[model samples]
Target chain A: MRKFFVLLAGMVLFLASSLTFIYVKGENDSVNDLLSANVDALADNESSGGLDANYHRIDSKCEVFVSAGMQIDIFGIGIITAKADGKIAIDGKVVCQSKGNETCRPVECSDLYSVILHGGER
Target chain B: MRKFPYFSFVLSLVVISCVSQTKNEPNVQGISVDINKQADISEFVSSFDGYVCLETYEECLVNEIRKLKMVGDTIYVADDTKITMFSRRDGSYLGKIHKHGRGPGEYITLTDFDVFDSRLYVLSNVDREIIMYNASGDVLRIINTGEGFSNLSVIDEDNIWLYSSDSNDSMYNFILIGPDADVKAKYDKFSKNQSYTIEDITFCGSVSDTLYVSQYYDNIVYSLHYDGYVPLYRFDMNLRNTVSQEELSATPLSELHKTYKYKESFRSIMHIDRNRHTLFAETWCFLDGLALKTCFVKADMVTGKSHFYICGYDVDERFPLFDLSDVIGYDGKVLISYLTAFSAKKHGKKYKIGNLADISEYDNPVIVFHTLNY
Candidate 1:
């Protein structure tokens, strides 16, 4: 029984170590790939989140409704506001000026054409 | 020695789960996605407007159903075989016109072969030439494209559109055929891009006197407007909303998956959006995707802005399109026909053909608009 226990312990240790090695190797490989792909180096993780404006309009007024508590890539939190009203949530929490688009109100189908968000010029 | 069946239990669970998942999918280069949950407009098509297999005739051994056009009662298909002519009412084979190739009267491979003004025009892969034929399949004449040839479409009896793509890319557009095939019209200026080449040129709507083109490569679809401004619709393939690549890859362990750098960055848009100004698309791709997964996207292309949501079709997970001619759209509908890897059921029984490659198995599917608000 003691011998068996020892063998089991060795097996567990081996698996744990192997898994750790693979995971770390995967992370390194992935990071290298990411760097090679983007001609520009990785910007600071905390770099000012800029809005990659995917949508456009004839005039400047546009509204985006993202799910609450979702992490949005968007930055510039304080000065901007949505056309709709909802719990301003971000990062899985109801946040105040949540610094991202996902924390904003949930957009409804009624807001299809677009809501007149006050300003996103920041 | 506390080990009874603990490791065995966990390992069994993992192996069994992995095997079952692999059984449902195709072995592909890219990732596997939740294709079943993806939007399928097939249910939205009117039953009469959907595909009805020609039960009485032999199926064409064509590799693709390139460029479908419906004129009056006839359904014209430029396929791997002879140009197929069928009756629209019950999918009856009317005739297969024109031998394809470059040797004397033959065409190498037919791409976007069509009939206009009772004249048959074919784009040949063999000759890299355009050959014309009368209705009786006689060689009318291999029109002298004074410049190097690409692909051609009938602009009129005397005018043809010759499109060119990157040399590496099998697709071509910027059609400069007809009387314009000569050097003065600028037909031979195209060269392959070092990093990427033109795959194919899809015909967007011609506004007044100008025509629009869309170029597909990697995951990005560039909207080319030689005469007007066009909106570029980028579908970043790696953008994660609610699901992560870990989650998606975890769902299917039998396959290797990679999340792209962005969502909406890479995708193919062809029959999906016929009009550049309109916001509908039926896109398909094989790799640079999760493998054999095709998507139908609805894009709103108004005010030079494009927004689209895409989902995978052909859940069996095969290459999207090996040749540019794999998918088609006509009259507000799209058709995706390929060899399927999964056993598609017909009358409740699975056919012997498994996966999307067996073009012989199931009927070609059409996407009916579930949302046609515009």
Candidate 2:
């Protein structure tokens, strides 16, 4: 009985460690992918380097509003729509999140705008 | 089924380990502030003076005042398009600068401006240059800095500091440039790519020739030294008010905003100003998606005792100009901000203070000055 209990405990411990590793690794991988994808858009070519992927460079005259379902339209940069069910899409590509996903969360219209436009809440 | 107890125990252990990864360990150094608590208005300002209405004219039409600076008797108000000057005593209209072109000494867009020694230094990010002009708007010199920057401050005759928060997309966040537009020194390079957007031109300010700079997303405020930066103060935020820096860096950029945890968290360090041994830091946080809460932190550099307060929140007596929301310039001695005719009249009546009772809603904005204790 004692021997069987030890073996069972060992199996559980191994499984737990493996699960935790996968969880952390998955998060790091997603972050890495984001950084890598922006390389081309944020390259350091002086002539064309004014483009900033982290900010939605809207003209001061362009009116911005946070309406129902988090809809914001920047004339040149396509439309961004975020739904209360945890779905965010820029030009229908679903860049921020999917419905009921724990990954991305928005509490307000400006938060949605910040996520969609400024890349982060800060 | 009989072994269910053992299995459940193992599962609980796994959950605990995962939770421990994000456990909040209170920061031991610096001063920790509870930003949500109510505070007294007197803590921010020692005294409140009257108001002055800036004279408006066709040539000095301002859509909105983004920044206000004072040099001697002149009050410089900069909007998105141009910089207009007014008398400090009576708000009389002085000369104005409205040059917007691609030609010599012209700026495409007015991003930032500073007044030092009767000279106006305007930062043109789109043109990637600094246009130095006399108080009368005559171009003294133009220095083209090859790269664009968000803010610039004249440190002295030889050193000028240009700062930007877009580190991932830009070469450096802090660059010390010479009068000749040469890069004297560059600092704040990250090992990995990172970027955050901020809209304040007050991120960098000086008191007595010493320069202070703070990144919006960073917790530490640094003073520029000869070689690098020296960390002056660290704001240890309560766990309830902030997301850990590690968590912020780990989250993917696309999913960062969607993180509900970040919705009501500490947003950014908006402005930093120092007065003698006391340093004042104004911070912003999301109250909700639609609103924002401003927090003011006053820290004693010598004793390390800090006072944290929320502005425009519950207070016994509300002071309009004392709020950090409209804070334009603070030079250790005086704090200045602008109040629209509506607000000036409304607050002036409710509080029974200032000369704003007679101002009309159609009139120009009234500038209010406050005397500081710290």
Q: What is candidate 2's lDDT per residue for B3-99, written digit by digit as tens?
A: 9999999999998866764363222136667655645677777887666888866766666777888888898999867889999999998988887
- Against the hidden true structure, what lDDT does model 2 obtain? 0.63
Please give each candidate's TM-score.
0.47, 0.66
For A1-122, candidate 1 gives per-residue lDDT tens digits of 99999999999999999999999999999998888756343353225443442211110012233221222232222222321211121111111111111222332323332333343322
Best model per TM-score: 2
What's the DockQ for every one of the candidates? 0.01, 0.01
lDDT of each: 0.41, 0.63
Model 1 stretches with alpha carbons more than 4 Å out: A1-122, B1-48, B55-67, B101-103, B146-150, B168-175, B187-201, B204-210, B218-265, B272-278, B285-289, B300-327, B333-374
Model 1's CAPRI class is: incorrect
Tens digits of per-residue lDDT, candidate 2, A1-122, equal 99999999999999999999999999999988888767655674435745323322211111132222554443223354432111221211122211111232222333333333432211
